[model samples]
Target: MKQGIHPDYHKVVFQDSSTGYKFMSSSTKGSDETIEWEDGNTYPLIRVEISSDSHPFYTGKQKFTQADGAVDRFNKKYGLSNN
Candidate 1:
C-alpha cells in the first residue's frame, strides 16, 4: 500500500537440468557424490542436509521441547509468582 519500498524481483532458476539431474540419497549405495553439470550452464548446486522430506513440521511429528529456565522467566515477567 506504500510506495518507494518493495522487494526486488530477481531471476531464480528452479530446475535447471531435468535430464541429467537426479536426487541421490546420501544413505544409498552407488550414488555419485559429484554432480556433472552441463557446459555453459551457470547454476549453483546447494547442499542441503535436510529438506521438507524429513522436517517434523511438514510430517506432523513436531515435538515440544521443554526448557528449564523458560517457565521461571515467564512467571517472573507476568507476576505469576504471587499465586
Candidate 2:
C-alpha cells in the first residue's frame, strides 16, 4: 500500500544455463542483458544454473539413497545381533 518503498517488479526471462531452456516470469531482479521473447517483446535476461527442465527431481533422474531403519542402523553400527 506504500509508494516508493517497494523494489521494482517486472517481467523477466529466466534461462537455464545448462539446458538453455527459457521462460518468462516477474521478479524484482533486473539485468543489463535483454532477450526478444516469442511475443516480440524484449525483456531482461536472467541466467540461472538450474531450472525444472534440467533439475534431477523434475526430470526423474534423481538418485535416492536407501536408508536403513534406525534399529537396523544402530545394530549395524554396534556390531550387535538383531535377535
Candidate 3:
C-alpha cells in the first residue's frame, strides 16, 4: 500500500471524437483537458476515437461489404471483376 506513489482516480468525461457524445466515468487516466458536463460541473476531458454511439456493431450499421460496393473495391484492388 502506497500513498503519494498512486495516481489519482477521479471523474472524467469521455467524448467520442467522431460523434461528440459525452459520457461520465471514473478512471486513473490523467488529462490536461477539461469539459463542462450537463450537471453544470467541469470534469477532465478525454477524447476517444470510437464509442457505442458510432460503432458499427452497436449501431447495427455493420456493413457486410456487399451492400456498399466494397466488394467491388476489393475486386479492383486484386485485379478481379464483380461479374
Candidate 4:
C-alpha cells in the first residue's frame, strides 16, 4: 500500500478496430480519445487491432494443423512400415 506511487487505474473502453466491437474494462493505460459507454458514462477510448470479436480463435475461424510426430516423420522419410 503506497501513496501515489502506482499508475492510475481506471475504467476504459476497448474497441476492436476491425469489427467495431467495444467493451469496457479497467486499465492503467490512458488515452486522449473518449467514448460514451452503454452505462451512459463517458470513458477513455482505447483502440485495439484484435479482440474476442474479431480474433480467429475466439470466432472459431482458426485453422488447426495436425503436425506429424518424430516417429511418423522418420517412417514417412524412409520406406519403413509398422507391420
Candidate 5:
C-alpha cells in the first residue's frame, strides 16, 4: 500500500468563480479591469477572446489581414517584378 502526503490547498473563493465569465461592457476587455477583492487584491475578469468561441483555431476559420503594400513586399522579396 502506498500512502500519499497531504497537499496544501490555498484556494480563495470570489463572488464570481464561474468559468467563461462574461461582463456587459461597451467594448471587450482584453485582460483588463482589475477588481479589488476583500483582501485588498486585484484580478482579471475575462480570459482568452477567441478560445472555445468564434476563432480560427477552434472553428477552423481563416481571417485575412489587409495591410497596405503587403503583396508588393512579397513580390520584391521573391525577386519578382511588381509591375
Candidate 6:
C-alpha cells in the first residue's frame, strides 16, 4: 500500500511464441517491447513458450514423445514382448 515500494502494475500483452496467441492482462513485469492491442492501446509485450491455446493438457490432447532405444529397454524390463 506504500508508494514507490511496489512495482508498476499496468496492462501487458502475453503472447505465445509458438501459436502467436496474444492476450492482455495486468502485470508488474517490465519489458522493452511494446504492442498495439485491439483496444488501440500500447502495452508491454511478453513472449511465452506455452499457453492454454497450444498446451496439450488444456486442449485435451496428448503430446507424443519418442523413446528411441529406451523403448526396447522398457519393454525388456517389463518382459513386454513387442509382437
Q: Which candidate is the best by lDDT?
A: 2
Model 4 earns a TM-score of 0.81
| Per-residue lDDT value at 2 in model 1 | 82
The order by descending TM-score is 2, 4, 6, 3, 1, 5
Give me the runs in candidate 4 sitting further than 4 Å from their true place.
Answer: 69-83
C-alpha root-mean-square deviation, each candidate? 12.0, 2.0, 5.7, 2.6, 11.8, 5.3
What TM-score, to 2 decimals, does candidate 6 have? 0.69
Clashes of each: 0, 0, 0, 0, 0, 0
Better of 3 and 5 by TM-score: 3
Worst 10 residues of 1 by lDDT: 24-33
Candidate 4 local distance difference test against the native: 0.94
In candidate 5, position 79 carries an lDDT of: 87
The candidate maximizing TM-score is 2
Scanning candidate 2 in windows of ten residues, the lowest lDDT window is 64-73
Candidate 4 residue lDDT tens string, 3-82: 98999899999999999999989999999999988889999999999999999999999987666676688898997998
- lDDT score at residue 83, model 4, on the 0-100 scale: 97
TM-score of each: 0.29, 0.86, 0.66, 0.81, 0.22, 0.69
Candidate 3, residue 50: CA error in Å? 0.3
Model 1: residue 48 alpha-carbon error in angstroms: 1.2
Better of 1 and 3 by TM-score: 3
User: What's the residue-level lDDT of 31 in candidate 4?
Assistant: 97
Predictions in order: lDDT: 0.47, 0.95, 0.90, 0.94, 0.48, 0.91
Q: State the local distance difference test value for candidate 2.
A: 0.95
Candidate 3 lDDT over residue span 15-82, tens digit each? 99999998999999968999889999989999999999989999999966555577667778899874
Better of 2 and 6 by lDDT: 2
Model 5 C-alpha lDDT per residue in residues 28-76, reported as the tens digit of each score = 2244445554566554444434443454665668776766578878878
